[model samples]
Target chain A: MKKIIALLLAAAMMVVAAGCGGEQSASSGSGSGSGGKQITMGFSQIGAESEWRTANTESIKQAAKDAGINLQFSDAQQKQENQIKAIRSFIAQGVDIIAFVPIVETGWDTVLKEAKDAKIPVIVVDRDVKVSDDSLYVAKIGTDSVKEGNNVFKWIDEYMAKEKKTPRDGGSQYNVVVLEGTVGSSVAIRRQEGFKDAMAKSANAGKYNLLASQTGEFTRQKGQEVMESFLKSYGPKIDILFAHNDDMALGAIQAIEKAGLKPGKDITIISIDGVKGMFQAMIDGKANCTVECNPLQGPLLMETAKKILAGEKVEKLVYVDEGVFPADVAAKTLPERKY
Target chain B: MDMLKKFAGSSLFLPVVALLVLLVFNTIFVDGFLSIQLTEDGRLYGRLVDILNRSCSLIILALGMTFVIATSGIDISVGAVVAISAAVVCTMIGGRGDGVAQMPMALAVLAAIGVGVLCGMWNGLLVAKFKIQAVVATLILMTAGRGVAQLMTEGQIITVYYKPFEYIAGFLPGMPLPTNIFIALAMVLLVAVLMKKTSIGLFVQSVGINATAARYAGINVTLVIFLVYAFSGLCAGVSGLIESSLIRAADANNAGLNMEMDAILAVALGGTLLSGGKFYIGGSVIGAITIQTLTTTMYALGVSADQLPVVKAIAVVIICLIQSKKAQEMFDAWKARRMSKQNGKKTSVDGKVAEQA
Candidate 1:
């Protein structure tokens, strides 16, 4: 009878230990957890799609380290289903805050609502989600993707304006082509729309036409293939190649060399996502312009979290600042340009 | 006439018919998609060539898989074997140009084949020696193989330095054909010759038909299972080399992703029964060709990114349905009558069946 009682006590002790472990991890991000554990944070990345994505991932890791944040990382691998699954796992884990770079802008409302109901603050970074209710996300910390596109087209138009070059003097003087990103993606839709709007609004550069717009799916191989087709069809007529992202732009540079053409002079190029490669491209005079898409989320997110915690009003839409890099300026600033 | 009817009654007839339907549909809908074309190089250009070059890998895989499945076994590890062999070749060359290219292409290919064989042997040992389920054994290797490729290349595209290596992906001058297509075709022919033309092929079919019966008859079941997997591994190596050369680099991230799935799909589409007994090498090649041609056509038509995966899924499912036994039974009945009428018109002085044909 004594042995049975002892076994029961042991089993009860194990259950208590397991419960405490579950509770500790769950409440770690609360900032009120015992023994001063830095706020626990869960991050969901939208898969490694390219070199830029890989760099974005590394930057996040570094940010987590500098801020002393317990980062629970998950790679959705470009699958919306996986992203949803990871967020649910984060909620169940009871982390203090939840953050994710959305795979697409939709299908996040239900999960975001679940996180909100749990009293866990959800922060969106890099990309924004399209939810009917704005309260589902605490604050979206991302760059102005529309302006990023407008800036690329605007820079090209401005350069042509400064050169005093007009296509009316020659036939098909600067036939520009565009490589779109993923279909139905917030970045792809907004960038394409913004670029078109800006280009159309320009009375002087309206002569510069977009000959082709095809989806590269934001992959290097597809970018190379699409660029190859454009070159073959356009021949000497093609002038500028505007890609939605830097990785595709880099791939087009390789294709240009593969096809026996000069990159910067023969085919002027511009892209978004001021990644290390884009900077390198700018420094080497292979690419013309790039709009930065900052991956650093700590300062903005931490400040917002503090405000929310302090019961002070916070900004609903927090837009990260974007800057452009020209060939001359990029060479000087290459060393200091952090992603 | 009766003999012809019996032949048509075979399970492969429906798959062949479904392939025709897809061809017709693509011809109608897809722009610039007609397979019949002549290039400046005096060779065929279009869907046929696309299929020939790409289907070679899947054909070799399916031929080997047919043997394994006959023993009521499954392998989900062929993709891993391809990755390992490709990685091995890329590492051997180490992306050195103007120097490493001096080495004989045959030696490098043989070494790649050796690496694949080693991987296959490991899989065989795990399943046969340890008494593990075929799926479980292959699954273990499948998960590890990707990591092995990543470790080999240090997670970078390791480019190779070989001129002849590029030829395996396409063809040399005067051939006007992709080397991979021929390799695949030759392998399929070899498998068909072995199984239909040789006793060992018959033995494999018999063993798959009924393992207990084959064992009772004193056939070596274990040896047959081991050999099939090993051969499948060899096919995978050849495929990896050819495919890697096409890209000019070994990208471990997407090199062999979901390839084993495609091979299985092709094998099933080619009218090869998964329950294991009989094999269909020619039909399997056709199935692989059908898949490649479909992808090429979709790309040519400028199909959007989101729509590509859905299109592929629909095509595979529809082909599988057409290859089903019920569809085959229906096709055989239709084909037999058509054959008889054609024969009647050919032999008879009257030529009445010409109108019907």
Candidate 2:
């Protein structure tokens, strides 16, 4: 009798779960069907692992709602296999459009080809996917990481000029310690490339020396640990810090404080990814500057989807104009910053 | 000669030799590999200090692993348990203030450790009562643990700003070394004393050697197995606290990634057989330090992060070769052959001399 009761309870619970799933899908289906020739969009996100990612997911969800477009969302949880599965499922559902932020670059050819054969257009976001066929994805929307890195150096150049400390004019020599993101990641590579390229073009190029550059793995904890070691290695000679992301910058701030130095003033910090934490740091004068890698691409993305659905030609690549945020503007813009 | 032979034949001899060899290699090839200095804050800083400091979590994990492996059982869910503990603690604290404990930090820590113990109990129940294979049973938690953490944190990285909390993994006021090192040492001493002062250690070894035989011998085999896994879970909880405090956040996905593998490797490198039996806690501690030192050395040498794993794999292979019984036997056989060949030449020379005479 107990076993029978347990089985019934389990079955009832499963029924409730299935019902909930049905209601969710049905609402989305109704939402898409309500408008004239409603376009359904299936978006595969790379899971909400960080604050930035969570904001990104929220942006897309909110954008789809505001645009009155039916959206099917899949959280891949940072796995390529899960992303591929989500994409294939979208294809099977025959959604009007398929879009995803890929976890990695490779191993998507077969799945993308499947989407291509199904006559569905796929939009890539945040991260790029490498496929043999060009038409696999209709468009890619992401910030130029190289430009972001270049902006960091440009901010430094202007700051030095304002201080009347241009290195090339026999002013002050600056020593920099770079905290890179995950090594071999395209974002990390391009950011490094852009920074180096900018440095070459800058007038203070000869006066700047790279003390030590190491991978922080794009994590705050690693950034702090790496910064701790850098402090031990370089000590007072370190003049500036260039981190790949805001999390690393935040971490380096803690490390610098622990080392008994003012982070923004003593060791000028320039990082990419203008997340709220970095903005807060800037307002507090703990971070010198940050280059924006806008996570709120949802509005623009949904707009593009609407245009694509209308049979309008779209560009192969859409570059989001992300600007650098300095300490002064951080306070005023903190209220309006979406992500 | 007799003492040297005894030392060489000890179970811990290989691990010690491996550690010494690594230290020598690092000192010779890596620049300032042995340098230690005191900063203005009076904290000891250097590659060696970094290795010791970083190895605290691994050392704690390996301590639990030593007992679990001694019972011929493995707990692969320790890493996941770490994530769960971090989530519980960070969420409880909830980033209340300027690195200040919103609630009593001690309570939050205890709650996290309690969750760890509960997780261990679940594993123990599965293995001890349900008779599920240890790996598969732990694998269930290993897969679900991170997800559980994600659920607890609502898929957001919970960054805590509590200052006192950082002391768990960071330096305390006027203290040169990290508090984690002391905590790890205390755990080792506690476990070591328990094994030494009681019959529990012998029962665990007997059960691991032969469960059926031990049951017949009147040992509480199930109880021993259960306690071992529960203990492993507790160690994972401690490691979770240290890790979360160190990072000042609860990152469910990345907190303890691949840590179980490292713990298992440390145990194996410590000369504890995966098949189970006699175990050494001290050896496991040293083994954890060795792994950390290798990582620090790689980083110091400026090896690109992508290539560090390749170098680590090659070093792991070399260490395994040194530890394998088959390789030892082959080496012995080669040495015997060389000795025999020299003897043969000696005899031939004597024969020629005789002929000349």
What would the per-residue lDDT of candidate 1 be over residues B99-159, giving only the tens digit for each residue?
3664566777888888887777777777666768899988988999988988887766665
Provide the clashing-pair count of each candidate structure: 3, 3
What shift in Å separates residue A195 of candidate 2 from its native position after superposition?
2.6
lDDT of 2 at A151: 90
lDDT of candidate 1 at residue B166, scale 0 to 100: 65
DockQ of 1: 0.13
Please report the interface RMSD of model 1 to 1 decimal. 5.3
TM-score of 1: 0.67
Stretches of candidate 1 above 4 Å error? A1-124, A127-138, A155-216, A221-292, A296-314, A322-339, B1-51, B54-56, B80-115, B147-198, B309-325, B328-357
> What does candidate 2's lDDT look like per residue over B13-33, in tens digits?
888888888999988987677
**Prediction 1: B-chain TM-score:** 0.85
Q: Judged by DockQ cut-offs, is candidate 1 incorrect, acceptable, medium or high?
A: incorrect
Residue B226 CA displacement from its true place in model 2, Å = 0.2
Misplaced by over 4 Å in model 2 are A1-50, A57-123, A129-132, A163-173, A257-262, A302-313, B1-9, B324-357
lDDT values, one for every candidate: 0.73, 0.84
